[model samples]
Target: MSRVDSNNERLMILSDVTKVYPMGDTQVEALRGVNLQIKSREFIAVLGPSGSGKSTIMHILGCLDTPTSGTYHLDGAAIQGLNPNELAEIRNRKIGFVFQSFHLLPRATACENVELPMVFAGINATDRKACAERVLDQVGLKERTRHLPNELSGGERQRVAIARALVNRPSILLADEPTGNLDSRSGAEILALFEELHTEGRTVILVTHDEMIASRAQRVIRILDGRIGQGSSDNHGRKE
Candidate 1:
């Protein structure tokens, strides 16, 4: 596998970021002064146990939420204060998300499921179908394009999810515990596919709690107590 070159352009920067949530009369800080940088074409894992605020970080990175304090710059554009509609636009244009649950619509075929994002983006039927088939072929699911989720195996379903994620050709592919529901063999296949995508120059950020899973990335960022710890290291134990 090709590693992320240190000279790659910077894709994202988080400066002293923080996130807060309100509960009744109490306020909870989900992230506390976290700073991070990610480069284009980098495959990295955000590793954290439950309640460590990794999900908050993911939300911020994915443009699903904004920071409570500090600044986030994606591709040189400030992201901390964008409105919901603006954020949604950025998400549709720049980020692709894959979740553990393989959120495929039960009534849709693989091709139709992959075409949903383009449908939202107002892509016409012909282009949507073409792009969907192209990505499904890229993900090794061309033959299964007509199959529904229930007709596929766990790995195949996840592949369809991946195809859906990639159909937009987003700059960053963010996967949250992507293999959490798969058997070991299927999970390995998905990881291999991720590596393949990384080699093809896609920026992949995998948010996972499993050490073994995190270890597959080129670098790992560990979060604890809503803060980025000193344990952010490469696979060889070098600080990133």
Candidate 2:
């Protein structure tokens, strides 16, 4: 079991975080004083309307984009001023991301697509291949490892993406609209996979506009106008 303490074992922390974008002479506030804590093995949903800054929060958490102000700590390391290379290293080592569009290289097979991140991190051929194959099998994509993205169904492609995300064995899996492009059946399959991962002690943070999808998470954070709203829950699907 993972111990919870400020001194150790916290998977993610965001304190008074804000991201401001320069729009001509003015600034657009993407995230306003957002404060959140995500512990190891927690399944969280950051839910909000389209412009509510959930995207900004996701970007910050994934290390894909930096906040304009405030602090973010991942596994006890302060990450506010880390440079691109450093951030990339952290992203590769600690964060796994699944986006709605299923960002797989068109020319690559499922196994090859899943191996991309590990490749960038300098994992050798044998180990990388093994890791990719293992994760693909775990995600129920073993039979599709040789298939190209176009050859697979939408759900299959998404599963491939999930396998790719897990190939690096990241402690935190950050998914953005993971079910957005899938049908209800596919979406539910994805949610079930998330549940399985959560049960297996992975920290899963999912961002989505669908309350139904958000319902799967144990915690739901509703954001409005760039700040957290007045709602909170471990039962997001319950009647409002």
What is the clash count for each candidate, in the order shown?
0, 0
Q: What value does the lDDT take at residue 19 in candidate 1?
A: 95
- TM-scores of all candidate predictions against the true structure: 0.93, 0.93
lDDT of 2 by residue, 163-198 (tens): 988888888899999989999899899989988987
Cα error of candidate 1 at position 76, Å: 0.1
Candidate 1, residues 119-210: lDDT per residue as tens digits?
A: 88999999999999999999989899999999999999999999988888897999999999999999999999998988888999999999
User: Each model's RMSD to truth, in Å?
Assistant: 2.9, 3.1
Query: Which candidate number would show the highest lDDT if scored against the true structure?
Result: 1
lDDT of 2 at 46: 93
Model 1, runs deviating above 4 Å? 1-6, 236-240
Lowest lDDT 10-residue stretch of candidate 2 = 1-10
Please estimate how well model 2 matches the true structure, expressed as its whole-model Cα lDDT.
0.89
